[model samples]
Target: MTDETQIMEINKPISKTVVAIKRIDYVDIAKGIGIVLVVMGHNDFALISPFAHKLIYSFHMPMFFFMSGMFFKPDLPFLMYARHRFNRVLKPFLFMILFIYFASISFSNVGIPQASRRLIKALYGNGHYLDWVQLWFLPHLFVVSLFAYFFFQAVYRRGLFPLRWVILSVLFIGGVLGITLFWPFEPDILGRGFTVFGLPFSLDLVFVSGFFSSWGMS
Candidate 1:
């Protein structure tokens, strides 16, 4: 009959329901498998087989993105999300880039002319060959994460059903088909120009699709 006792009784059912819902196990399994595969794929060891590499490349990173989307509920304010994202992504990207630049210079015997030219090209806009091989995923993943976060926020705000799997599938299919249709039959200036769009189409499509799919949207 007391106020405190009444409050406790009223909250008990809700708390128990939440506790029951929190015990889902599939998410943890998916995350564990994805992380293990990612680490194995990245490691420079003989343990990796071609089939394993292909499987990891196909699903591991995408699964990570999807898992991220599942938990993309921005509880903190927008400013907090922005600050966290900058610290987690942009700062590290800059530091790694600078580190790679200096490391290349320190280790390589390439003459000053060639190294300087390559450094200048990388700093300006022309992509570096080293970057093409090693750190390419960082920038691409950062962009995809930022996009997914903002997209999830918008979806939450609009009160839309997060079942966007069909929409994502359409985008993915359309993008692939469009790229295939415009595939260059011959090497030409314009043919090369079309290749630039390929990254956005393929990367973003996969990233967002994985996100939605992990959320049971697919």
Candidate 2:
């Protein structure tokens, strides 16, 4: 067989296979645009004018998270929910981690020992060490989804809580307090004031996320 014919024969699976799925054009398009804005803001934040960066920063994440919240199925069965989280969030998170490990060790010339240490740290919230600021969102999103799921199940789903909205308000207030109150709790190393990062599990902004996600339920 000719080289071109042989190549075509070998590529039959990809070339001939097709799969179709329904999609909502507006939602998908809006989300695509939102993602572009966010990526542009992050990637070229410094290069772009400060005002433009500020504009993107102001709206992009809120829009993204709000859309995410809008899709959360609070009433989903526990097993299905767990499997969905695993397939969607955990899989991407693990893949990002593996990619980071390779990039740090090879492209960044970091040693395995140091890279592994950073990998562990990155799993929680330390993306700065790996120079991977973006992946921090993945873990934080997973945690926030879990928080919303449990909260929804306990209060709204069960119908056992009376002042649920009031409780939400109180928690929101407390979350605000937590952001300002980080330094006092930041001290760790031998009682020295080392200070925690901007947020843990994105809890500094958990109030915002929680609000939107909860809003999605109603």
Candidate 3:
């Protein structure tokens, strides 16, 4: 190889590192702020005024989804990207939720039958059903990130990035409508009157969170 080509090769990795550092710098700051807000929001019931608590809760979670989108790349194939996400997001979610659930069974007064029922509900991945409610964000984020990948891939592959905002807006609106229309349909399982809400894995919130993620991408 030419000396010039060697020099280019040496600089490429350095340049990439610098670019990545620059890209995530502000994102890191925003994420730090959001983290503090999330903690405060969770514990602020009597520590802060009602309006202050409301303000903190308003955007903390959406901010995370938005930041997650900022890291999206539409270049990877579907399975590869999905596997990567499974390892990074879903795996951690499963590990932590299981850890908490088992800890409750081992130490707390939770009985085996009750624990079994809770485990079943936890499969739904909805916060309301989990022992640790705050963990609901992980599975929800995992789904949103995957949805964003497909949505962006479709747009990018079709050379429709120019119209991405319009497409995203339509999809987001449809998602909202679907959620609204289905809000009342709590289907009973086995005619036992047990109902599931928001769908498994929080799939229903995809478009809602997608809007924030799209903003991050833009």
Score every model by TM-score.
0.58, 0.74, 0.81
- Candidate 3 per-residue lDDT, tens place, 1-218, comes to 99999998888854344443445678779988998888788884636588888877778888888888888877888899888988988898889877877888899998888887888888788776777888788888878878888777688677998898898889888888888554435676777664455677777778888888877776
* Top-down lDDT ranking: 3, 2, 1
* Pick by TM-score: 1 or 2, better one: 2
The most accurate candidate by TM-score is 3
Model 2 lDDT tens row, 27-64: 79988999888778777575758888888887777676
Runs off by more than 4 Å, candidate 1? 1-32, 42-49, 76-79, 111-134, 178-218
lDDT of 2 at 218: 55
**lDDT by candidate, in order shown:** 0.57, 0.73, 0.80
lDDT winner between candidates 1 and 3: 3
Q: Which RMSD values do the candidates have, in order?
A: 9.6, 7.4, 6.6
The candidate maximizing lDDT is 3
Residue pairs in candidate 3 whose N, alpha carbon or C atoms collide under 3 angstroms: none
